[model samples]
Target: MLFGAIQALQIITFEPLLLQCNLWLLAGIALFYLLESGERTNALRRILRVGVVGWMFGLVLAAVQILPTLELIPRAVRGAGFDFDTISSWSMHPIDLVNVVVPHLFGDPYTLDRADYWGESFHRGREGYLVSFFLGAVALLLSILSFLSPRRNLQRTLLGLTLLSLFMAAGEFNPFYRGLSEHVPGISLGRYPSKYFLAGALALAVMVSLGLEVLLIHEARGSRARRGVLAVAFSGLICAALGLGMHAYFQSRPHNLEAWIESMADPKRAAAKNFPVVASQLNQSLRASGIFLGLSSFLVLVSRFWEHPRMSPVLLVSVLAGELIPANLRVVPLMSDRDVEFVPEVITYLTRRGPNEIYRIVQLDSPLQTFSGIWAPNRSWAWRIHFTRMSGQPMYGIMSGLQYAVFYSVDNLNTRDSDELYGRAFRLQGADGLNFLGRLNSRVLLTTSEIPYPGVRVMAVLPTNTDRKLKVYWLEQMSPRAYFVSGVESVHSHKEALERLSQPDFPADRMVILENSGVDTKPGDEGAGNARVLSYQDRRVLCEVDAQKPGYLVLLDSFYPGWQAYVDGKEAQILRANYAFRAVEVPAGKHRVEFSYRPLFFYAGLALSCMGLLFGIVSIFWSGGPNGFKAVLIYLKSRHKKLKAKNGLLA
Candidate 1:
């Protein structure tokens, strides 16, 4: 809003340079503070200093978000065999959300939706709207009462502080979007790391501090206001004491702590994978509660400084809400996943496949409607039956030459017995569904999985002779199976699909057996003990004499227990690479690649950058921040009035 309002204002005046409005704002705010606080400081210099400091702070957060430290990632593991940085660019939506709400709440929550909302009256998904409304109205009402009260002395100061305390505590408004005139100066010190909604709470905190500071100054300046100051201060103390007591009784962070118990109690599966349904519901509740924590804690600190009798009663409410953002949000990210596990793959496959093969798929799914529906006509195929939702004809309305692949099912493939959710992606076309022709060229046919057709024909399924050969992608392309461009050099011990490479002729290149070949066991524990033996079995490499290609090749002397092979850079499936040792038919040219596992630094960097942002946010509201905001304000106000008056006559 600050930006938008300024832009609108500038349009009337027709400013010279458009984007550099921050300079203008700096000048304006400095002047406003000067006028409001009464000339007690240097206008220009102080204005520039505060502006630079605040902007620099924001810049630092931006840099950290873009930096490479994986601070953004919630979890990092060594040797996990997964990389997040195979692609460029860190996802910013999650980090941005926390950037707005964290400092106030002191915790970050998880959300899959990518958005950065900054508004005084904004709510994502849902908000305790009624709760927020009541708090805000009461706060505004208290502030009005104080503002209307006469007497700028210590007595008035106490009332003023009470009002400010109420404003900060009530928090249904987002203050970060405002200009320098919105809230206290250092209130948003570390604001960038938090979500925007917390800005409302932060703004209110500034008011609390300002009111208290004014009261302190008023009492200090001669007069018999000292006892009144102590009374107000003492009253604030009581409020603080009561507030803490209430917090202890009412504030309990939303936690999935029970997840641990449930996982252990479920004797059926591992906690790493299978989870009880209760954990999911708990996660949602935690997300909702987390939003409140940010608002509550902020209220607590502000109350300690500004305890007006009226404000004291409300302190309990604000403290509780502030605590909500931190408590409930801390666990939110644990559960948010914006992209479904299967969507990215569907997009990739649609982007890569060819026309004819897709046509064949259409024939297989909706045999009656396919132009060449001779093959797989009955639609009684296992894959089709499990995948398609409809029973008959309408599935082929648009799949004449282009196959309308309805479902991409994993359940139909290897885990048919497991009853997983994947079998529904691609199946036979149903009677009710209208098929839309996908825009894909014939090149996609080259990237088929176990079905391998069009340009990719499966030679034979030799499950006995293990040999998995293929380049490994740094980031696993989440899909039902591996996709290769017809250079069929994959032999997974786990998959029973016929192997057929671009070059069907087996390369007679020799393969080498590399293994640590060791056994770990205690003395005399060789029986059924923790000791195991590794008996070397004969392992060999055969190829169509790729003495023509440039890679190491030698027949393996023996297969050690944990031996595996890769034709190029890709790592083979466990025990599967235990044998793609059959052959490698590379284009007769020099190729460079390695088999060691590498980490995904790109994603890691994104994670770290976000984490830094998180830290920056928490640091902003460290309570009793760097002082002298009044000085900065005094300077700006003087300059602003003079500049406006001088320019006002001409306008």
Candidate 2:
């Protein structure tokens, strides 16, 4: 995309604004080829041979990568470490099972929004389908142009370069370059430039075929002049290959990798905490300039020894092998699935809390970099792939509205002793502010305790005990002006905060906040005949409900061993693992939203999507055969054979 964008700008543009955002980088590069012609030379065969030699070098790199991959190396680059833990992927299958009977599940997003969770994914599928079709068509055309173009003027050379750029671009941007992300926008970058490495393969193929043809036409004869450039390129390629190899090896090493992996084995561990630090260490070595510099330096050193053909090819091939190896294993270990001591209480709170309810996710930055490695790993010293694992990089987190709107670093988890962290800062202004308020999920109360700002008054303790470890606190303060603004952002009024957390139904006998705790099995049921008091975990709770359950109790991974859940009074099912939260199956009715981390079912949905995708791709492409165009003929032939088999069976 970068190359394409660059090329597009070079061409005519009535307005410069297009260059900033709407520019097509790849298209410009394609046009660059159309305008240039090959230089005529009698040593065509010799030129072809050189190109072929370069390609063979690429093959050697591929070999290096393939050997390890075939051996099942855990850190094998290309297709390794693909994660899709986002909201869109998990809610699919569970929604589908419910929708199967509902029948009103399929529709456009606007219409389907009311259907349920499953409806949204398929509805969104329409947009994704369109995007994928567009992307596939573009990839196909680029591939064809490179494949069919003659090797003269080294048209293949330019084609190879463009292809490399596009591939590298894809590798950098796409989540899983070959599989899932191919359908998305330009891929993000990583530890290794995948697209560029893959392009090297195509370049090798081109160079080899052209070189062999040239050798057939003319015997090998050449004066070794610019062996320097060749040497430098070869060296860089070699370093890249070796660097990635070492990285993968160290990252997957038994001692280093196992320690992190073991950490995650505990259900109490947060997947974010157990990230591999060794991977980061190696990433620093694989820095972009490292390869380029190493290669260049080596070439300069070996420039004097390049006269012999045998020596030259061997040296060049060694470099090529190095480059190819790293190129092929382009997977970057930006994050790993490791375990950390997960805050159990936090997870419980999130699960128990209703949907869209807000809560502060605090990280204390004073003693150390809290949540630093987990949220983002330090890959700064590494090569600048467009997308890298930088420390504290803003993440896309989903828990409650707090995860959505703003992330707090100086919020409700700390204490300022007796000196007043807020009072000292605001004393210069000479006036105390009104007490700030945050409506959970709606307007968040921006308290001095929560944000460490100027105006606040001491209130009391929450969860009512020091032993519980809840970050809740009590405070009173004022700030009509400060409330108007908090930091660079504005703050809503007290009334607004209450309104945010309150239901739109206005006056209620009592505010019925429907939490998607997934604890209650009977969704959409009422609060009719239920026990008034119950006890669990040394706490007394009251349950009141009607005959019709009218809410979503999605107990995502809220499973704790031996834990039993009841709605109103009836016991619910504990269908999955002990620690994992389960979403309670709601009965039929107009309901509220509550959910938990019942993920095993989500994985089942992903499996189904994968199967569907595989089927679709295979069915569409199988008929395209060796000739590449006779899809219809192949289809007819297969159909005929199937029909014959059916007839024989009947007989």
Candidate 3:
């Protein structure tokens, strides 16, 4: 369990918390059942105990990552407020529920040259859920049959879980979901509620297996076979009618189809060129659905006449494969291998820099616009613009050993600061905007469109012949990474510091904003100081500073917690300056200044994990075999009692 948790944290991109939440819920359910059973079965109790220990072990194993993440989340944008409309953007459509049986109702757009119909919505007009909720036609029928089996308790539990998951996946459509998001601590943190489909899928699988077993082992084989045949026949008729209705619906919506095809071809006019191709794919999907349902019905009918023990199971498996495999094939081609080596000419131009020179580059693509455009693409060119915004150019900076002024991550610790700086620099266009970038040592600006600014010269026009060319600009008069400011002004709040930064003659190079309260400094003390960076790394910076009198040395790095400053190996206070940058006070004289990241919580969590591991190992050796687990429990109980008694005495 510990190993699985660590791997999930590292690999899973979509929903990192889904697996943990499901496991926790399952453990709680199991414990509840064990307590309610009244038998107190040793086997059941042992299983529950093992589950609890495994969960604790996993939590301990991931404590280093978990601790910092918890501290950072509450301060993040998403965690600070819960937006219902934003969360509902990824909700599953009610009609998409039919995908559980027939997945290719709309042809797979990813694999096919073009889908019969397409929308710029989530999953390209398909369901937004991670995995299709398809349980196969036979599995669905069997799951319905499982309710009639003798295992009523198990069936009820599985059904309850499935219903609960589906309700959660509905997002804004379900009232219960809104309540859950409001009350549950971590539930609202999940961006996509459709991720709950994972729990539904698991429950469906278990129920399907139980249903299949029951159908294959009934005492009255003939009666059961007859019932199966009737059920399949009725379902087949319903599916055939639905398929025909869909065909008619598509025929009536030809204008929508033509518009979609035209958008793909020209992106400007509503004149369809590949109408025949689109029509052909739609017809193929309709025919395929009809044929699969017919074949499944025939197989079930044949089983009624045959009394062989294995015939029903074999036929069911064959029907399931036939129904599901082809639907899956149409979508498999969408996942093309990424060519990591395909660097564009514009990127190549920016990678060329002097060994000793350090500067930051700001990409002109607005993150706010990009996030908004992701959901609402009403214009023909919106798709292309959004794609460019979501590209990996910012990540390329790291690979090319260049510093990008803007950086984002799933757990963006410096989101508020970064957003403020980005908004001031790129979003607001003027001399003040230019100065904002200059203060952060941004020497280059990359843009998709022409942005004219003073002191910025066009460095290169990448792929000059192409319509979608990347323009690179060389910015002049940017500040150095580390600089000495002789004068300082104490600001009570971040708002005041930001307002000061916008002043035309703000003396950004001469003075720094010290956010600490009641700090006294002489305005006329213009000390002679020089600071030169000796070494620079991602989390650590070393500099040599010589100040004739007391002054402040400001570093143009995002002011984040856990970064500690040291002057000649002695610790010094790090103050927030210019709203997002770091500053440290230096006494008169030449000395080495170093800034290093040392997160206290991570180390504390690591130490606790180590101690817990040692205790587990010691308990195993002391108690011997499976009894070791019980011995550990006993020890914990005794410790709890002692702590309670000591608390009482203190009280």
Q: Scored by CA lDDT, what does every candidate get? A: 0.29, 0.31, 0.64
- For candidate 2, what is the lDDT? 0.31
| lDDT, candidate 3, 94-189, per-residue tens | 655766665654443331223233422434333244545555565676576566556667777788777877887777777777887778776666
Higher-scoring candidate on TM-score, 1 or 2: 2
Q: Which parts of model 3 have CA positions greater than 4 angstroms off?
A: 1-54, 105-139, 219-229, 232-234, 241-283, 304-307, 332-338, 341-347, 354-356, 367-392, 395-400, 407-414, 464-466, 521-527, 614-651
> Ten residues in a row with the worst lDDT in model 2?
480-489
Q: Which is superior by lDDT, 1 or 2? A: 2
Tens-digit per-residue lDDT, 344-422, candidate 2: 2334444454233222222211212222222223222121111111111122222322331123322122121111222
Q: Tell me model 1's lDDT, rounded to 2 decimals.
A: 0.29
Better of 2 and 3 by TM-score: 3
- Give the best candidate by lDDT: 3
Taking all chains together, the TM-score of candidate 2 against the true structure is 0.29
- Where model 1 places Cα greater than 4 Å from the true spot, the runs are 1-32, 36-41, 53-64, 67-141, 149-197, 208-586, 589-592, 595-651
Candidate 2: how many backbone clashes? 78
How do all models score by TM-score? 0.26, 0.29, 0.79
Q: How many steric clashes does model 1 contain?
A: 91
